[model samples]
Target: MNKNNTNSDSSVKTVKRNKTRESLPPKKYQVLEQDWSINQDGVNIYGRLYLPQNLPGKKKAVILSHGLAGNYRDVTKYAQYLAGQGYVAYAFDYPGGAKNGCSTGVGQLNMSIFTEEQNLKTVLNAVRNRSDVDRYQVSLLGESQGGAVSAMLASKYPKEVKSLILLYPAFSITDYAQVAFKSINRVPDTLNLFGFTVGKNYFAKLFNYDLLKSATKYNGPVLIMHGTDDIIVPETYSEKANKKFKHSKLYIFKHAGHDFKGKYVTRANRLITDFLKKN
Candidate 1:
C-alpha cells in the first residue's frame, strides 16, 4: 500500500513537521498563536489565531482561508495586521492534508477547497462558540480557491456572513481544467491522465463551478480585491463577481501579480476592518 494511502496518525490535527521557515521570518505582528484540532468530521486542521497584544473591549472577528497547497501561515500575516487594528483574526490549515496526507501524495489542492467543510466548521466553532468571542460580528476572508469556498459558504449561510473579502478568488474550476487539458494534450494517450490527483479538481468530482455564480446568491457586503498582473487567477474573475454583486466593493492593484502588492496591504486591511464594522 502506498504510504500516502494509509490513514493519518489519528492523534494530531494538521501535523506540520517543519518548524523552521528560515526563508520567511515571522512578521512584526503583535501575537501569533495556533490551536490544532481533530474535528468531529475526522479532519485535522490548524487554527492559527492572531490576537492583539492588548485586548480591545469587544470587536468584530475575521476568519481567513489561504490559497491552494497553503497553510495557516499563508495568510496569518494579514490576520495579524487586522488584529493589530483591533479585530479577532483567525486562519487554519487543513487537517491531514497539510502535513501527512500531503506528504503521502494523497492530497489535492482543488479538492481541499471544497472539502473545507471541516475547516470552515472549525473556524466558526472557534469564533461563535468561544467564550471570549463574538458570534454576530464574524466575517470571512479568502484567497485564490479559498475564495471559492468562502463564497459558497456565504451563500449557504447568508444571515451568518456579514461580509466577504475575496482576494483573487478562483472563479471557475473549469477554466483551470480547460487549461490543464490543453497542457495534457502534449502527453500521449497511453499515459494515465487521472493517474494521480493533487488539487480540488480531482476530488469534489467537479465539472465546473463559478465563484461569481455562487456569490450572486449572497446578499452580504462583498469586497473583491485583485491584481491586474495576476496570471494565476486573473483580474476578470474578480471584476465579474463585482458586477453581479449588489453590494460589491472592488480593489484593483496595478502591476500586482498573483500575490497582492505590499503597498495595498494596509489598504486591503483597512477595507476589511471597515466592512466588518457595518451593522
Candidate 2:
C-alpha cells in the first residue's frame, strides 16, 4: 500500500510556479520651483510653477488661484503638495489681484472679479502651452474670491478644465453688493467694504451674473470643501454649489474656519489627493 501511494504521488502532474512578479517602487519626486512670467493681453502675470522632477512623460497639471487680497504665497503649500504627487502645479499672482504681490498692480479702481478672470485665463493658456503638461488633464483650484473666478472660468471653458476644486468660495459678492448699495441705481464709483476699496465696475460686472447658473455649465467633477464654522463665506454657498455641479462632492469640516490650518489643512490635502487620483 505504501508503494502504491508513492507511485500515485509521483504520477501527480507537477505545476510550474508562475513567474514572480516584482512590484515597481514608487516614483521618487523632487519638487522644482520655477518662476514664470506670463503675458496676458499685454499684462504681465507673475507665477511660480512646482514641477515634479524625475517623472517621465507629460504630467497632469493644476492651477492654484489665491483669494481676495492674496498672492501666490497663499497657495504655495497646495502647489508643492500636488507637485509631490507627480503633478505639475502652478500658483500665480493675479495682475492687481492683491494689494501687495509680485505681479503688476491693476490699482483698486481696475481690480475686479472680471480682471481676475482674465488673469486666470492667461495663466491657463500659458500652462497649456507647456511641453511637460498634459493639456487634457488640467485642473483649476481656487480659494475664496478666486474660487468664484475659477468657477466662472471652468464654466466658460468646460472642455479645457478637467476638474474643479473650490475652497470656501465666496459666492456672495453680488449679495454683498446688494446689501451695500441697497438700490442698484445708487452705487458709488468707489466704496470701502471689508477694508478693501472696491470700484463700481465690480458691482456692475456682477450685477446680473448668476454664479449658480454659470457653475452648471461645467459638467466635470468638482470637489467643494467648506468649513461649517466659516464666517466669511457661509457653508451654505458650498451646499448650493454642490447641487449646481453635475458631478460634485461636498465636505464640511467640523470646527474648521474659512482658512484651514494644522490638521485641517492636512485633511484637506489628503482629500485633494484622493479626489484627484479617483477622478
Candidate 3:
C-alpha cells in the first residue's frame, strides 16, 4: 500500500494529515490519515482518507456521506472509528453541501439532492480507484440526505457497492418539499429550510426520484439505523426502508433524535462496526 503522502496523479493532491490525539488504533494495525481532494465539473470536492497503515493486503473501503447543510466533519468520527477496524474510511464534504464547506465552487443556492448524488458518485469513483482499496468490497455509509444518495447509487451500481448503511436517512425529502412549496412554480429563488437557506434547486429532482422504490433495486446487504424519537425523519421511514430492501436490518435507538448523541453515539458506533464486520 502507498504509505507516503505523495501521489503522481495531478488530479489527486496529498496534503498534511491532522495530528490531534485521541483513540489510536491497535499497534499492529495503526491508521494513517491523508487529506484528499478531487475536482469534478470545476468544483473541488475535499475529503479525508483513513487507511490502516499496518494492515496487510487489499482492504475493504467505506465512503461516509453527510446530511444536508452538513459537512465532512459530521461523519469524521465514524470514519476514524471504521479506520481503526481495518477498513478504509473516507469522509468528504460535498460541493455546496454546506454553508461553509471545505469544497469550493457551487453555493447552497445551486445545491440539490441530485448535485449531491453526483458528488457522492465522484467520490465513489475516486475511492474505488485507489490502489490499496478493494473496489468490489466498497460500501457506502450515508447520513440523512447522504443516505438517500447512497441508496440511489447503490441501486444504480448494485454490483459495485457491496453493502449499504443509512443513518436516519431523509427519505421524506420529497414529501416535505411538495407540501412546503405545493408546486415548482411556487418555489422561490431562495427559502429557509431547517434553519438553512437554500434555493429551489434543492427540490429540483426530488419530485421525480423515488428514493425508497429505487433503494429496493440494490440487492446487497443493507443496514438502516434510526432514532425512535426522531421527529425530523420518523423511525417509520427506516422501518419502511428496511422492508423495501431485498436484504436489510433496521435498528432503532431509543431517545435518540435526528442526530445520535450521548450513549446513543456509542451504541450507534458499536452497531455500525458490527454491521460492517459482518457484511
Leading candidate by TM-score: 3
How well does candidate 2 score on lDDT at residue 110?
A: 73
TM-score of 1: 0.74
lDDT per residue as tens, model 2, 1-279:
433212121111111222453232233588999999887556888889999998999999999999987889999878888898899999988776675777874666678888888889888988988999998999999999999999989989999998998888988777777676765578888877666777777677666767656654577888888887898989887776776677777788777788776666666787788889877
lDDT per residue, candidate 1, 160-250, as tens digits?
A: 7768888888776546655555443342332222233364334333434554565556777888777777887878777667766666777
**lDDT against true structure, model 3:** 0.80
What lDDT does model 1 reach?
0.63
Off by over 4 Å in 3: 1-28
Q: Which residue runs of candidate 2 sit more than 4 Å off their true CA positions?
A: 1-28
* Ranking of candidates on lDDT, top first: 3, 2, 1
Q: Per-prediction RMSD in angstroms?
A: 12.6, 15.7, 11.3
lDDT against the true structure, per candidate, is 0.63, 0.79, 0.80
| Residue-level lDDT tens digits of model 3 in 1-279 | 432322221121111222453233333356799999988789889989988877888889999999988888888878887887889999988888764689977787899878887888888898889888999889999999889889988988888898999899988888787777777888888988888888888877666667667755677888888887788998777776776677787777666789776566566677777778788
TM-score of each: 0.74, 0.87, 0.87
Model 2 pairs in collision: none
